[model samples]
Target: MRTRITTIAATVMLTAAAIAHAGNVGISAGDYYSPTLATTLTAQGNSVHAVGWYNDNVLSTYDVYIQDGSSFADAAALDRFVYHGGTLIQLPWSFTNIAYTADTTVFSRRRRGTLEQLNPGIDVIAPDDWLLAGVTLPEAGTQTIGREIGNRFADGATPVLEWEDGTALLGYRRYGAGLVVGFDVHLVTADASPLSADWSNRIIGNAISPVPELSTWAMLATGATMLLLRRRRPD
Candidate 1:
């Protein structure tokens, strides 16, 4: 009887761990892949795969898909995937404007040195959002100009993180039944500073990690209580 109780307890713990870490993520830049990003996601406890192309079948396999600034021909397939409840994370490349609603000239300026581009300070526009939870904005990264989003955002989109000057660094919105998240910095690069990399990793981890629902917590509590009760009942 004691052995059976122990087995149940072990099973409960394993189940909880699985629920907390189980997320299938795909990292892609169309034909270009980021090994650093893949390894980072793997370290964060998610099953990460490299996506070579964008299609309905490929997109459907992942709960979260990351587009690391590559241009692809199959835009419609990606749209359908998001429409049918697949989360998409976009990391725009150098000299491109993403998620901006208005003027693009603010991000078009060229930088001559790393010092001119790497800005570590960030402005938190959405402090209460779960994506920014437990993360300090000013410490997030040394995001470069033209590598992050501009201040203006599309309708219904929420900017969670931004440059000190108010240009968006990260943002998200709901599209159909899924979510679309945009990160302006190049997180996949090995060139980022240690502090910046740590912060970027933390945010990406938050994006891919699953939070257990209230019902799941209740069920686990009930099961554990029953097990304890059985173990203590005049045995």
Candidate 2:
């Protein structure tokens, strides 16, 4: 009875996997903006990883934001908060205060050569504590991307912004598997137009393939043993 149950379960799982792989689903969160945007992951089977990218330029200083709900209605819902140097901070769901200053010394030290010279004439607003360049899975499931702001900087800088024809990589892990999503916004200059573009749609079609599940190997071994036993029986 136990063997029969296991066989039935495995068969069901295989059928589900076949159906999931046969029809792929994709999601996109049009452009980069403040507040959290929520979307679904399709073609990921029972378990799947998700990755995404944004133009670093969209963030004035260094901050990140995520989607709050399945739609754009609850865009202001606060999720996870991060600092310019990649430090995680805490924010209340209704919190809205976003003010900060750059560490001139650290900023200057990090900014050498062209970056230092390019600092002038550009507006660099320190991102709120609740922001991130990208998000990950597992962690993101509980957390969210906060608000995002794109700023204009001089060209030829080492780290470019998201709205400047750049790319940001965001990935997530699901069910011991990995999923990666990339956003490529080809904007010639720094502007909000790119933020309005449906970059997320482009991302859904570009999901990373999943790896083989461990159960597959176990099933293969079982099949091999059954074949050997049948051969030895020799009718």
Candidate 3:
């Protein structure tokens, strides 16, 4: 009986550990920008995957998905994944890469005076949101020049971050069972100084490696209670 209790405790501890570890961050195959991303996230202890193929069940397979490619397999698949509770971080021009064939949804776009591009300033609309941890945007709410990158969301999308002209730099939209956090591509700063480069890496890291939920704690507690009860049982 003592051995059985020890085994149960070990099993529960393992489950608790797995729950705390969280999901893997999927970086698109040809995204050229993900190497730094992987490095930053890994340093923070997140399992990052370079995704080569995305078919059925693909969206649900990952905890977070960054639209890093110039092309994605299916928009409907992505939509389903988000509403189903998957987190998404996107880059600029990702709209051009994805063919939203499932519906007539229109993604918006605008150029800031045709010259202010690349490395645009980011905003933090939801300060308390878990996805925003270790992230800040000083250029928010101001006309900041970027790497000429530009993309906007459809009419119904909620703005999490916006450009100087009020375009979405980062935004949130609830689809089915998930939430989508859209990001402009140029905002990705990686492999630079600790103060600046690859800030998004922490964003992805924090997303895939979140704190233990109540259910996770409950599971751990349940196991402990079981062991305690077993120890006190009249043998």
Instruction: Give me the candidate number with maximum TM-score.
Output: 1
lDDT (Cα, tens digit) per residue for candidate 3, span 4-47: 66667667777766775556777776654556566666677676
**Candidate 2: tens digits of C-alpha lDDT, residues 58-171:** 322222233211222121111111223221111111112222122110011111111011111111132210112121112212212222122222222122113211221222
Q: On a 0 to 1 TM-score scale, where does candidate 3 land against the true structure? A: 0.62
What TM-score, computed on C-alpha atoms, does each candidate reach? 0.66, 0.23, 0.62
Off by over 4 Å in 3: 1-21, 101-107, 110-124, 138-150, 187-198, 209-235
Kindly provide the TM-score of model 2 when superposed on the true structure, using C-alpha atoms.
0.23
Off-target runs (Cα >4 Å) in candidate 2 are: 1-70, 73-168, 175-235
If both were scored by lDDT, which would come out higher, candidate 1 or candidate 3? 1
Could you report the Cα RMSD, in angstroms, for every candidate shown?
6.7, 15.9, 6.3
Better of 1 and 3 by TM-score: 1
Top-scoring candidate (lDDT): 1
> What does the lDDT read for residue 170 in candidate 1?
75
- Of candidate 1, the 10-residue stretch with the lowest lDDT total is 97-106
> Against the unseen true structure, what C-alpha lDDT does each candidate score?
0.61, 0.25, 0.58
